[model samples]
Target chain A: MKELWELFSVFFRIGAFTFGGGYAMLPIIQREVVEKRGWASDEEVIDYYAIGQSTPGIIAVNTATFIGYKKKGLIGAIFATLGMISPSLVIITIIASSFMHFKDNQTVQHAFAGIRVAVVALVVNAVVRMWKKSVKDLVGIILFILAFLVIAFTRISPIIIIFVSAATGILLSYRGAVKE
Target chain B: MIYLYLYFEYFKIGLFAIGGGLATIPFLQELIQKYGWVTSQELVDMIAISESTPGPIGVNMATYVGFQTAGIGGAVIATLGLVTPSVIVIVIIAHYFMRFAEEPLVKAGFYGLRPAVTGLIAAAGFEVARVSLFNLQEYLDTRKILDIFDLKAIVLFGILMFVTNKYKKHPIIYLIAAGVVGVIFKFG
Candidate 1:
């Protein structure tokens, strides 16, 4: 029960603090869950993200759920997932009720603009870190370049690229080209 | 009953919406078109607001729609419905992932997956950088290369890039500092 509450609060902080969603949440999760709590490993977080990105629902929510379940099973999953959504529920409901006009507020707009820019740096840092660790071989380099281009230039779903990359890995291992 | 119905719809969305927050957009568009949930213009507005907010964009949208439809209770239910699938699916997947972690096929798949995830995130970073640093519309209107640059934003981005690499501080500190600077500079 104590661990479950810890999961809830940790995820609550993650959901509340991180803006510019999607990849922006990655570094925060890494620091909070992996570094602080020792709840998950760096490799495990990456795996959760890989699975989270490919699966259904929001990646952020999916990640919290996976980590929560890993630590304490079904109830832990519920608490963490709830914690993840709590801020959104409160903030959005409050805004919807009376502060919808805040959308046009200049101060709020400027702050978000700054947050967005800083978010770029965050994502870049994490990407650079992962690149060093993950992109070690030629196949890794090729897959990295191809995935980057396909995602950046084309309209293909990331899921398809992920599947193709997985198939490439499997086929290479089977052919004695790469050892996993 | 209406709340339950709305919640069920969100549950279906959760079940089928692959990828992540942005992936839920198409389904949202369909809902707006089919049921006039919030109108096309409102959906666009919601998207803009949702993107800048602190939570998952999809969850924010769901809450907004729920609030508009049935107030706070609706918002809570819709949010719950959206995440329910994730908890169920991930729990099931984790169960199997652990069981299969040792299989060569799984390891090989992971070898590919890790890099691809990094690649996808790099692409996402490029997108955030484009939004934060470039003035696409201004460049289009002026037809000048220099018009594309937001000099202030670029300066902030550069400073942040340097400092973040040097200090290795928690992201929250950088976020707070940048937000304060943005407000002071009137980034808009």
Candidate 2:
């Protein structure tokens, strides 16, 4: 029980301080969960990250749940998810109540203007890393290009893209074009 | 009652957003357009705020949208709604992820998902870029152009890219540097 509480506290700190979303959260998770606690290995963290990305929902929440569940079980997942979200909930509430003009301030705007570019770069970093890991063959490469074009240029919904892509995978598997 | 609606709405967002938080963009755009809960400009502003602040952009956006529609209680509902599905699904998978961690079908599915998610993430990147770089007025007539894309942003992006490539450092270093630049250029 004490260990579980510790786990929750650690994750809470991570979720609290982490800005710019999942990619930004990675180093923190590595520090708390892997280096400080020795709860999981680097490989395990990477695996959890991969699974977290493939699954639905926020990557941070998904990652916390995976780690928490690995540590304990059902209860751990609950605690981790709560820990991940608690800061955002509290902070957002505080901002909502007191700071209606928060963004209007010049300092805040400038900071954000800087961060916005960083956000794009971070996203680009993620894409490059995933492309290196995921795209092995020509078919995967072609699908990658097609999906990028469809969403970038067209008004088609992303859900439809996911479905079509998944279906194409299933078909490719059936034809033995790709290996499991 | 309204809270429940907010919960279920974000639950849907949680269940369907395959490529993570950014994938929530198109869905949120649809919701804002369909419901008129918030204005388009507000949504853009929310993105700016969400991206610049802490936490997941989707969660922040959900909270903003909920607040716009229903206030504090709405924020809670929307947040819970967004996260609940992840909690449930991860718990269930955690129960079995070890036993089937190397299963072929599961591996195949994720392998396929890799390229697809890459595509989704790229799409998201481009969409945000479209909003950030290209002004609507600029498209209609070049004469009506605004300084939508700042040179500072480009320089920051280029330098960060160089730093990231040259030496592996924490993201905080880049964020801090950018924050300082923002203060000097925009704040000062």
Candidate 3:
């Protein structure tokens, strides 16, 4: 119905414009779904973001699905995901056709160089924001630091780390040391 | 035949990638080493291009590899392959996530995820930095060793970081500025 089209277009615009992926997409989701549409409250959006991150998928797609379903159910989820991915699919198709031919073009190369630096800035901003909100207590801070170091210095796969941390959370909850 | 395998492989990646696009790098590296579809150098180049482009890095990389492997159709297959799992999972989760949202165990599980996700994000940051900024080959060659660091880039990074951090400016401003700098440097 009309609602489905709205969901599609809204997510289409978001997917088309969002450049840096999950972290960059976060604020857009917040503004559009939470503030403009009243689809979810601030806390709910945060919760969805956390869940979206932990779940097995692209964060933005997962988030859009969650929000879309929240608003309109199964059909909404389908439309939202389509909207989220369609732009990439189309754009990548075009790029795939042309990029190989222009692989070493100076303007393209220089543009990429600038974009990479900007990506660093984007990721840093995301980390700083999440750090303020996520690292609430000593244990959380410890986990953050330890996990960051383990990831940075070691070659341990992140999937293993996530599993271990989840287990730790369960055990801590069992011991009544932390309130989940 | 190969397209089906590629699809399934990326499906696995899409199914298990918990954090984001960058979290897919190590997984893709494993694929490259095992299958020979891509080389390490190509992976590095893909990362650079993917990050710079206007889409998800994983999708972009998948498309690039697919295009290289089997042309345009291959690119479509790979992109779809990488994205399909997430679409399926999200559809299922949407029906049930709220019912489970309140359970203490679920909360604890996600709480645990926060730190781990942070770790993944941090690792991704380090890897990109290492690839983009620290080119040891330039040092080994000794010619224009100083250019290895790309001083203009570093200064731009520093200024952008300070301005954004201090002023809490919108990210678009920085993106526009970077684009302008790229044009100036390229045409100058």
Candidate 4:
């Protein structure tokens, strides 16, 4: 029970504080789950993130669920998932109720404008970090470039890109193994 | 009835919105067209608010749309709907597939997936930059090169990037600082 609560609170804090969504949440999650709590190792966290990205649903929520389940099973998963979203639930409720009044407020608009720009920076930071970790060889670089171009320019669904990339990975690895 | 509809609709969204939060936008666009729950303009506002605020964009947008259509209870149900599929799917994977982390096939798949995920994230970042730094729509309409860039936003972005790269402080600190600068400078 204590562990469950801890999981909840940690994810809750993560959900509450993170801006710019799942990718932006990565560093904080690394700090809390891997570095601070010692629940998972760095590699394990990356694996979870990789899985989280490929799976359906929000990457942050999926990651929290994965970590929670890893630590404490089904009940742990429920608590962690609940904790992760609780902040958003409350905050969004408050915003929804009063958003109309503030919709046109100059200060609010300006603040949001600023926040949006910062969010772009944060996402770019996430990309840099992810690139350093994930893009290691020619195959990885090729996949990265292809995925970026497809996603940025075309209307293709990301799920297709992910599945195609995974298949490409499997085939490439298999070929490399055979060659050796 | 409304609760069920919210649940059913968002359940589909959760089931299919692979990649991450922003991926759900296409589905939400469909919902707007089919249900007329919110206008296109309202959906745009919701996306802006969801992106700017804390929390995953998927969950935030779900809550916003739910609140608009059904109130607080609606918000709760909608969020639950969005997450339900995730919980179920993760549990199944946890139970059946956790041991496969060492499998060669799975490892290969993940190897490919890592870079793909990075690319997807890079694309997301690019999208954000386009929205924040460039007024693409306006430039498209007028063909004015000067109108394309938001000079102030670019400057702020550059400064924040340099600071973050140098110091590696918490992201929230940078976010708060940006918010403050935006208000002071009356950006946008």
Top candidate by TM-score: 1
Candidate 1 segments whose C-alpha is farther than 4 A from its true place? none
For all candidates, state DockQ relative to the true structure. 0.81, 0.47, 0.48, 0.66
By lDDT: ranked, best first:
1, 4, 2, 3
With candidate 3 superimposed using the best TM-score fit, by how many Å does residue B61's alpha carbon deviate from the native? 4.1
TM-score of chain A of each: 0.94, 0.69, 0.75, 0.84
lDDT by residue for model 3 (A10-113), tens: 88777765665665555455556766799887556655656676678777777778888888888888788778777777776676577675566777667656
**TM, every model:** 0.97, 0.74, 0.76, 0.87
Tens digits of per-residue lDDT, candidate 2, B1-188, equal 87887888899999988656778988898887777888888888778767657777777778778877898889878988998899888888777878886776656555566686677667666654555334555446655445444456667778877877677665556656777787787721
What lDDT tens digits, residue by residue, belong to model 4 across residues B58-172?
A: 9999999999999999999999999999999998897666888778888888788888888887887788788878898889999999989999999999998898889877766
Question: lDDT tens string, model 3, B69-92?
Answer: 777777778777877887788767
Off by over 4 Å in 4: A41-46, A177-180, B1-5, B22-45, B141-144
CA lDDT, candidate 1, residue A59: 91
Better model by DockQ: candidate 1 vs candidate 2: 1
Candidate scoring better on DockQ of 1 and 4 = 1
Cα displacement (angstroms), candidate 3, residue A145, comes to 1.8
After superposing candidate 2, which stretches have Cα over 4 Å from the reference?
A1-60, B1-52, B61-78, B130-149
Point out the worst 10-residue segment of candidate 2 chain A by lDDT: A42-51
lDDT of model 4 at position A46: 60
Any idea what lDDT model 2 has? 0.72
